[model samples]
Target: MSSPKILSVDDSRMIHTLINKGFAPYDVQMFFASNGAEGLEAAAKEKPDVILLDVTMPVMDGVECLGKLKADPALKDIPVIMLTAEAGKENVLKIAKMGVRDYIVKPFTEANVIDRVSRLVTLKPKSAAAAPAPAAAAPAAKKARIATDAIKILVVDEHPAIAESIAKAVSKRGWKVVPCAGPAEAQPHIASTVSSEETPDVILVSLAFPGKGALKFYQSVRMNPTLKGIPMVGLSVKTAIFDQNEAKETGYIAIFTKPLELGELPDRIARAMDLDITPIFYSSEGDCQVVSIPQDLSETGSIDLTRQSRKKVADFVNAGFSKLIIDLTGVTKFEIPLIRAVASIIHECNGLDIKWRIVGDDADNLPNLPTVISTNLKVAALKELPNPFTNTAPLDIYPTRAAAAAAF
Candidate 1:
């Protein structure tokens, strides 16, 4: 099929620039018009697939332009999306009755424009058409993470409330959030702090900002040579695939949608920033180095466990710890990654001539144990394992942490 054609009729140069950036990754023919009169001319000449119309214009306002388009049988069929800053009831009602495809409020992200336009067109990725394919290289391994000090995160959002909520949630991990209203406020922040001790390690942006700030914020951030390599994360509504895809194209390391899954954000940041995390999973306890496994051993977490084993392996030897305790007291589920991770860590420790013992009870002490993800075969297989009460050989079974410690 031929490439889709789109036209934007906005007076603001920034909005036009933002729209272009939004569609930069797509295989589409873009047309621009500075005002309503120019939009009518362009729409007539190009017979575009869709038109993004602004409410207030010098020559002719959107209300008048839209009415004329609807009246003309040739152009009436074309989809039109209204771009407006004001959300007044009268204006909304007026435009609502006029049969515009949709309306996007200003201070929106490039993702927002892509999301709206994608509803009307099948967006084809421009990867092949835009750039020549390069030589393939080995996929980079995810670096082990550690948080020595606070990982400063810059949260750029229109709403301070949302940023504050995220701040409260992640503060426990020693991640500090610097909240800003928009790009304007964020500029000064980066200016003063980029080279300082408080430089941002990651940026979290709300794609649904108030006016037309998100796109501008992204542009300003990207324009800087120093910050070009910094990782960005897009925060958008869950249903907005286009926005998410746009973010992915623009090199956002992660796209977290609302309502945020409060559990996962920190992990993404940790991986992106690649902080040192040796202390999080392992600690020296008495004469043993205790490896505390998380309750839910996600695939990523399992991989991280293996990657992080390098540092603690030597630390135990250096500190003269004689025993390695695999503390699975908190683990309630059994997954392949978790099993593999434990086995790998055991091997690592074994290489150094250090002995390791697990500090966990049988099925009774561990509640809701599963062999893997809810498969009947796996569940049945797990059920056959002997409980502590029914075990024939009670070798190495520890009743408590004290018992485990005593055995070592």
Candidate 2:
């Protein structure tokens, strides 16, 4: 009958505050520690049901603390959900090897924290049974709105107001909207729906916090064979070219700015999920082959772009073309993966004794590329294309180029 105790080990006061606010609705008791050492000591005294561990800290880091916790006989069995900013595959594998129950990426919403913790401990307080009877009817009403054959859409956003508005808009079309506060909550929902008849037709994830769990979630889903093909759209408040590019690089089908045009969302979602969407167009000028990338390069589009680039480069080389030009003039924004794809094309051209140049505005510098190849204008890049081959310096100076090019 005692309340379930939960311990949070993090260096950030803001994260601690968010956790408190997130779990306030539940019946659990909360404890906090500023570092891994303090957290280990607190865990021994409190014997909490769950521990939320942060990866990066001033004192002992989360990974070291996790190893120590797992090694301890008394605390080893206690479920630990890691809170981390590092969403890379290598990091996830490392944490998983440490035997943590689960991990949630940072900049998470209240619902995200609660969703992960609830999986490990009883979150509802004993007082939950005393709630008014009328409140129980809400679930039935929600269930009625979702027809068994309806298109299922998953909307993940941290802000309650924004999430609700999206849910309301999508529900009007008779589609079922499964709204989640963050990536942690979204993952479970996505898994549960996979085998069901109403599996999501499209998924909309918020990019409010770029490197936080959103990109990580997208990466995780893509890695899973069952969930990889689903269309995913990114929701954002950012209008900067680089921000949009970052979202695209994560392989979102489309990036829509907030406050969203609810009226157009349904149509966009349909188009994204449509199998008959038009392919990216290619044109030839003189000896150069120019490919124009789509404005919204969704997951499918990204794959197509890569495939088309390879085929085009091969075809152009066979036709005796001397250069390949990726006309990104129409592309205001793009993802990191796209850049890698372009780099791959350039590498292929190099082997074929041909040259390649990317044409785009220089307001935002391309990530993971060296200055030798990048230029502010198409004319400048075209003129300088032959300079690298003329120089005898080792390509080691552009270290990130080959590594980034091979990443995808």
TM-score of each: 0.50, 0.33
Please write out the lDDT profile of model 1 over residues 1-408, one tens digit for every residue.
889999999876556666776787889999999888999999999999999999988999888999989999989999999998888888787798999989988757778889999999999898664565658865687454466556788998788887887898678787799998777788875663467565677898988765535656777777766677667888899998877787677677788788876655666567777765557778777777888777665555566667778556755654545588878875655665555556567666665556777777554533332222233223442343222222223335465566778887
- Alpha-carbon local distance difference test for all models: 0.73, 0.67
Best-fitting candidate, scored by lDDT: 1
Error of 1 at 105 (Å): 77
Report how far residue 178 has shifted in candidate 2, in Å: 56
lDDT of candidate 1 vs native? 0.73
Please, what are the lDDT tens digits per residue for candidate 2 over residues 363-387? 3543223443343213432332232
Model 2 regions lying over 4 Å from their true place: 125-408
